[model samples]
Target: MTDDAMLTSKHALVTGGGTGIGLAIARALANEGAKVTITGRGQDVLDAVSGAGIHGAAMDVRDEASVNDTVANAISARGPVQICVPNAGIAEGHSVHKTNLSFWRNIMATNLDGAFLTIKACLPGMRDTDWGRVIAISSIAGLRGLPGAAAYSASKHGLIGLIRSLSEEYMGQPYTFNALCPGYVDTPIVDRNQDTIAQRTGMTKENARQLMIDANRHKRLIDADEVAAAALWLVGPGSHSINGQAIQIAGGQTA
Candidate 1:
């Protein structure tokens, strides 16, 4: 089959698909002829990207009811979700001594719990299909302990653990579970973090941004499309054996 028709008649659901890495992955799947459903907390944000083979649904991944209802609606409208991308998450830096209970919970709720709820809601539909892909957008922090962002790192690490476990649970099945761990991808989250890091460290925004770029071995910020390309590959043909792997999209080796 042609690249454009590879995913024809398939359905994809991507959370936080309004912007950044999520948006990139959603667009790639749509371009491959999948009926894509993009969800986020803001209806306006989702609506802005709806069309051209993509649909929009307003749903908060942190809420179980919202995830359940939104996934059901998407399945009803476009058929089973053969491609599930739980790309909704928040990135924040907080030292353990300064991290309050609410702050840690908030990070887990959005990053870890959000992915769990989204995957859980999408799994039933995926199981009904002969083939399915679960691509969880994790971070480099998931592999290594990121100083000054204990809670954020923990949440991401938890995501990798969840993906690994699910991969074993569905072993021999037609579905695969994997996590994409990227370092400092150019996204709205990174843009916001630049300001936050500058304020926290009393450094210039340029210097703060440079710190992130320096973290990657390549000394440059990664493009969101680079991560999107990996997601597209995971869902494409010949990826059936690539399961339970933490594929790092960082500029180079993280450790």
Candidate 2:
């Protein structure tokens, strides 16, 4: 199939699709002719990016009722969701000593619980179809412990575990489950992290940002589109055997 028609009739639901990696992936799917429903907490943000085969739905991933209702509405409008991308998450860093129970729960609720709810809501529709893809946006922290980010790292690690188990559960089926572990992507999240790091470490914002850039072997921050390209590839042809994997998109080896 032509690139523009590869996802022609498929419906894709991307949470946290208003900005950054989620937005990039949503746009990529839409360009390939998927009816994309991009959800976020901000209605205006979603509206700004709506159209051109992409629709918008304001939903909070942390809220179970909102996730189920919004997903059902999306399915009713656009048909079964063949592609589910759970990318909504917070990337805050705090040492384990400083992290409170509430803070840790918030991280898990948005990052891990959110993915579980999204996949659960969309899986039935996907199962009714002949093919399905559940691509969870994990982090490099998921593969390795990130210093001073115990809660965030744990949430991402849980996400990868969930994806891996699902992949095993549905082995040999037309559906595939995988997680994308990206490192230091140049997105709004990184920008926020830079500021946070600066305040926490008493360094200039530039130095804080440089710290992330240096983390990558390429010595530069990864573009959001680079991660988006990986998502597109997973949904594209010849990716059937790529299931149950934690594909890393760091500039080089993370281990």
Candidate 3:
């Protein structure tokens, strides 16, 4: 798709847009002239970054009533959502034996159930529009197992399944559902995880960081903009042929 053919005069909604990958994707969509609504749990961060064609709303994707109300409000304010990006998630590593039901449910609530509710609420608005894109942000672990992260992996895997089935359901329709499985990205989450890794593996901070970097197989953390570019392509013109695919951004990971 050409620059001019990208999302212009269209409405888009991105969850967890306060920072990291979601913010990058929201900015990219906004740059293409889409009236993008970026949702997050932080009002200050959302307000700090939102401007131009971007609007920020405080939304906790875990709550069904909140998701329903927020989507309704966003649609009423900016028209129907043509592009829905379910990018909000919690990434962490917890041993299965040590993980409790609450821990597991919390992960599922935010990663799996959150994506489910966000897509479900946005579908009505998206279906009403002439064109639509539903992109779920899953992890590379969604495609395979990650040690000590059983719950997280399962949640991401479930998200991919949801997107794939939805894409098939709307195969002939104007809506297209897809998943972006990015490896490690340079985000605040990574910074936090470094501490976790250091504690778990008894490695120095630098060594812990290197461990994740090496895990990417490309031996580098991804830039959030790279993932944003993929989202732009899927919504851009001539991308109708792409659907129901888990587009992995993990560089050459043999895992």
Candidate 4:
């Protein structure tokens, strides 16, 4: 296949694809000729973004039935989903001492459990195909501690663990499993987090936002398209050997 039609016969499913990085990745895949299904909790948001080869499905990854039904419907409409992006997640900072069970479980349900359910639901169809990719949108916190966000860090860490183990399990198969660990991406999540950080630390919203930017090694927020480029590379030609890896898109060393 040529660069422009690399995914001509493929069907891709992206969770939380209404906006931000997920939307960016979905658009990139659709542009490359993949029939992309963008799923989110809101039908209107997904419908508004749907166009060309892009389709929309309302799905809540936190629920197993929702994941299964959405994936099945997407497969029926666009053929088996050869590309799966478990990109739906929640990011928040809470000191371990102050993090209650509700906060911790909610984070886990959305970030960790959601990835697990999405992958499990999509894998059977992927295995039926000759080419497949599972890209989990993780975070730098998965690689190391994120200070006050202990629960969020642990959920992301678990997500990476799931991807690693799945990669190992299907090592000899055509399928590839990997996680994209990005730091402070320029997304709506960052905007909401600015307010949270400002309230929590008594810093101005601008300072709070800049603090996250400064957290990146290159001292800037990573762009959504940059992460989408990495996803395209992973699913395209010459990436068969790149399995079980946590590719960091943090602009520099995150260790």
Per-residue lDDT of model 3, residues 87-167, tens digit only:
999998799999999999999999999999999998888777678899999989899989999999999999999998998
| lDDT per residue as tens, model 4, 1-255 | 355698898999999999999999999999899999999999999999999888999999889999999999999998998899999999988888999999999999999999999989888898887888999999999999999999999999999999999999998999999999999999999999999999988999999999999999999999999999999999988999999999999979886
- Each candidate's lDDT (Cα)? 0.93, 0.95, 0.91, 0.93
TM-scores of the models, in the order given: 0.98, 0.98, 0.97, 0.97
RMSD of each: 1.3, 1.3, 1.7, 1.4
Candidate 2 residue 42 C-alpha distance from true site, Å: 0.6
After superposition, which runs of candidate 1 have C-alpha atoms over 4 Å from their true positions?
Answer: 1-4
The residue-level lDDT of candidate 3 at 214 comes to 92
Question: C-alpha displacement of 238 in model 3, angstroms?
Answer: 0.9
Candidate 3 residue 101 C-alpha distance from true site, Å: 0.8
RMSD of 1: 1.3
Model 4 residue 25 CA deviation (Å) reads 0.3
lDDT of 3: 0.91
The lDDT of model 1 is 0.93
Better of 1 and 2 by lDDT: 2
Clashes per prediction? 0, 0, 0, 0
Q: Give residue 39's error in model 4 in angstroms.
A: 0.7
